[model samples]
Target: MKSFFHVIPVSHVIPANAGILMLVFLGLFCSSFGFATEPQAPRLLEVGVSDVFVPQGFDDNDNAQVVVEGIFPTTCYKLGPVKVDINEDTIKITPQAYFYHGPCLQVMVPYKQEINLGILKAGTYKLNILPDCPENRHTLSIAHSTNSGPDDYLYAPIESARVVSKERPTVRLHGVFSNSCMSLDRVVTHSESNRVVAILPIAKYENNGACLDVLTPFHKDVQIKDPLKGRTLLHVRSLNGTAVNVIEDF
Candidate 1:
């Protein structure tokens, strides 16, 4: 009796080692093709600015108190850290973070935080609200009060000053004044040649007895004799020779 030998095809007979290699290759290919899962985007939380307080006497190196309120979602936990950064005239706030839960199982919670931003100047400041989660940021303009007391005279020139007529060149002066007594005596113009070219007396509040102690708003149209020229400055002074405010390039 003759024993016949069986011949199996190489393609049909896959070795155990080759089977493991093919599985490893398939996994690598799928991962490279982005079959793996991706990370989720951060949740957004609502934040608002309740109030901002800048003390009257705060100088360039004084802290101002800011009150902020917000609501946290139920899908996360509040991480106990708040970061604040103060630039020249800007305040940035970074709120606490939230750890992800399985799902949003609870109701939204309300939270309030008070931050003391140190050493700010007495002027307009920009406050920026930044959160760790993915949400739109916010900005606010706040005016820090000056050190000038209520009794102390304070004046701020209005942004818009107009020359109604160039022929007579009647200048319109507008400003706000606060405190115990202030009078706009005259509008004096100085020329490039360093000479007093024109002196226009403010008719309404000129005399010493004409001064008033209450907060006053002044808008005066004064007539000038000579035409102003060459980088002139108009000085609006009190009767006591103290300059209340000056308008340049008139």
Candidate 2:
């Protein structure tokens, strides 16, 4: 009589390690495919008021020049006329930046332009970049020099504050700095339960010998634990151990 044998398929006799290897390969392939199919964030252009200057004793008709800067991710952008709005104490500008119809290559190009802000009194003025364009916007503080003497300096105050997140309890602040030599050191936040006691390290303007009195914008983000009930007070300090400024009842 002929001997009979049973045939086993190779798939049924696969080793444990082989199965695991196949699963890992599948997972990697799926991950790669997912990444390849994911949509990308649109490249954004950044516009800011780089510098502002006001001559001493300049009246409401003296033309002050403001240097505006733009950082572009692509070369297919055409900058339009910048709209300047002068309020009671604020100067708002909207840069008309838009993308033109063309092929764009990935490269960062920085460009700047000087704008004439019609005459105004010498005092603290806020420069806001209106969010009407498709690109990013920024606000700067124009601090008029004291003109008292060489030692006299003007400090940029905190203009506005808002809570960005509640889970991480992040606070966003907008301010201005006129001194170019000052560097932000750090921000400290003190909290008890839900009430915040203090945010240390206030922002201050110090004469570092090489400072140019040009009004510029500044921003800070502080992260803290979730507050229990009351508001938080925020402070800013410079690298030279100077208390710059603080915002209360934040």
The top-ranked prediction according to lDDT is 2
Residues 105-130, model 2: lDDT tens digits: 77876655555675456665666664
User: Candidate 1, residues 1-250: lDDT per residue as tens digits?
Assistant: 7769878888778875897899899989988996764756654433443322222223343344444555666646563456777677666776655556455668776655545565455565566666432222333333444544421222233333556765675667666555335455545443322312323334233336656557767777866666665434343433232223222234
Best by TM-score: 2
**Ten-residue region with minimum lDDT total, candidate 2:** 50-59
Q: What is the lDDT of residue 139 in candidate 1?
A: 34
Residue runs of model 1 more than 4 Å from their true location after superposition: 1-12, 15-17, 20-22, 25-62, 77-106, 122-250
Question: How many residue pairs in model 2 have overlapping backbones?
Answer: 14
lDDT of each: 0.49, 0.52
Q: Estimate each model's TM-score.
A: 0.31, 0.31
Residue 207's lDDT within candidate 1 is 37
How far out, in Å, is residue 107 in model 1?
3.3
